[model samples]
Target: MTDRDAFVARLGGVFEHSPWVAERAYDRAAATGLTAGTVHSALCQAFRTALPREKMQVLRAHPDLAGKLAIAGKLTADSTAEQASAGLDRLTPEEHERFTALNDTYTKKFGFPFIIAVKGLTKGQILASFQSRIDNSPEEEFETACAQVEKIARLRLQSMIPGDENA
Candidate 1:
C-alpha cells in the first residue's frame, strides 16, 4: 500500500480513541504529507524525543479551561464536579474571585486558556507557575506554552500503542 495510506490507516487506529489526542499528531502528519509511513517517521524525527516530538507539539496546542469536555482533569472547580485539584481550588470565595480574574486577564492577553499538565502538579505548583507566567512576554509565554504542550502530547502519545491503539 502507499505510505500515505498506511499513515491514514494507523491514524485511524490512534484517533479512534480520542479525537483530541489524534488531532495533534494527525495535523502534523497532514502538514508533512497525507501518508502514514512518512508522517509517522516525520513525527518521530521532528519530535526527536523518546516518545515523539510531534506528540509534544500536539499536547501543547490544546486550549485549557475547556467547557465540560476536557479529556484531562480539571484544574479549576468551575467546571468540575469535584474539588479543584490545583491549590487555586482551595481559594476562599474571595480568593476564587481573584483567581478567576487573573485567569480572565491571562486568557484575554494570550488568546488561549493558561495550560499546564496537571498530572504531577498541585494547586500551589500550578499557581506559582501561573503567577509567574502571567507576567511573561507573549513570545516567552508562547514558547513556554509550546514546551508544555509538547510534554503533554508526548504523554498522550505514549498512552497509545501502535496496534491495540484506540479507534
Candidate 2:
C-alpha cells in the first residue's frame, strides 16, 4: 500500500466510523510530515471543519459506553481496547445495570450516546461524567461529545505512530 493508504487503513477507526477524518489527515500529513502530533492536529482540523450534519454523524457513530455492542463483542477493536482499559469490560452485574440505565437516560436526553474518552479514567469517573453531562443542553452536549472524540483520536494516533511519545 502507498504511505497515505497505510496511514488511512491504520487510523481510520480513530474517530469510530469516520474514515474521512483519517483520509484528510493523511493528505495533510503528506504536505507536512507523518509525526503523531501533526496527524492528530490534522484529524482534529478535519473534524472541526466538517459540516454540521457530518459532525453529528461522527458523534452518532460512536457506540454507547458499556452498551449493547460491547456486550455483544461487536465494538470496533479500538473501542474494545479503550473500554477495556477503563475496566468497562469487567463490569459487575449491578455496574452493568447502572451503565445501561445511565446510557439510556443520556441518549434519550441528547439524542446521541454519551461519549467520554475512557482512557485513564475509572468506570466510576465515566459514570459520574455521564450523570453530569446528561443535564447539559443539546448544543453543549454535542460540543462536549466532539471534544471527547478528538481526545480519543489523539490518543489512538499517538499509539499507532512511533515517534513523539510525549504527544
Candidate 3:
C-alpha cells in the first residue's frame, strides 16, 4: 500500500466513525511530517475546524455508553474494547439500568449520546461524569463532548503509534 493509504488504514477509526479525519490528517502530514505528534495534531485540527454540522454528525455517530448498540454487539471493535476496558461490559442489572436512564436523559438534553474516553475509568466514574455533564448548558456540553472526543482519538493514536511518548 502507498504510505498515505497505510497511514489511513492504521488510524482511520481513531475518531469514532470518522475516517475523514484520518484522510485529511494524512494530507497535512506532507507538510508536518508523519510522526505521531503531527498525525494527532492534524487529525484534531481537521476535527476542530470541521463545519459545525459535520462536528455534530461526528458526535452523533458515537454510540451511547453501554447502551443499545453495545448490548446488541453492534459497537465498533474499538468501542467495544474501550468500553470493556472501563468495566462497562461487566455492569450489573442495576448499573445497566442507571446507564440506560442517564443515557436517555443526556441524549434528550444535548441531542447526542453522552461520550467520555472510557480507557482507564471505572463504570462508576463514567456514570458520575454522565451525571455531572447532563447539567451543562448545550453550549458547554458541546464543547466538553468535542474535547472528550479528541481525548479519545489521542488515546487511540497513542496505542497504534510506537514511541509515541517522544513524538
Candidate 4:
C-alpha cells in the first residue's frame, strides 16, 4: 500500500467506529509534513477538534465493558481483544449479571455507555469504576468518557504503528 493508504488502513481502528479521525490525521500529516514521531499526536488533535456531535458519536461507539456485544461475539476485533485482556471475557455468570446491570444503569443515567481503557485493568477494577462513575453528573461523565476514548485510541495507535514509544 501507499504510505497514505497504509496509514488510513492501520489508524482506522484507532477510534472505536470513527474512521474520520484517521482520515483527518492523514490530511493533517500531509499538510504539515508530520513525521511518524508526531502522527499519534496529530491523530489525537483530529479527535479533539471534531464537532461535539461527532465526539458524542465516537464515545457512544464504544461497547459497554462485558456487555451484550462481547457475549454475542459481535464486538470489533480490538474491543474483543481489549476486553479479553482485562478478563472481562472470562466473567462468571454472576459477574456478568452485575456488569449488565451496571451497564444498563450507566447508560440510562448518562445517555451513553460507560467507557474505560480496559487494557491494564482487571474486571474487578472495571466494575468498581463503573459503580463509582454512575453517580457522576452527566457533564462530568461526558468528559471522563472522552478522556477514556482518547486513551483507548492512543493504545490502539501504539499497537498499530511501529516504534511508537510515546504511545
Clashing pairs in 3: none
Per-candidate local distance difference test: 0.50, 0.88, 0.88, 0.85
Runs off by more than 4 Å, candidate 4: 1-3, 30-37
Model 3 over residues 100-155: C-alpha lDDT tens digits? 99999999989999989999898878888888889999999999999999988878
Superposition TM-score, candidate 1 onto the true structure: 0.51
**Model 1 root-mean-square deviation:** 8.7
Q: Which residue pairs show collisions in model 4? A: none
How many Å off is the CA of 144 in candidate 4? 0.6
TM-score, every prediction: 0.51, 0.94, 0.94, 0.91
For all candidates, what are the clash counts?
A: 10, 0, 0, 0
Report the Cα lDDT for residue 142, model 2.
Answer: 91
The digit string of per-residue lDDT tens for model 4 on 1-167 reads 88888777877778888888888889776676544446767788998898988889998899988988889999999999999999999889999999999999889888889999999998889988988999899999999999999888778766765676585
Order of candidates by TM-score, top first? 2, 3, 4, 1
lDDT tens per residue, model 1, 22-44: 33455566675544353444444
Higher-scoring candidate on TM-score, 3 or 4? 3
lDDT pick, better of 3 and 4: 3
Error of 4 at 13 (Å): 1.7
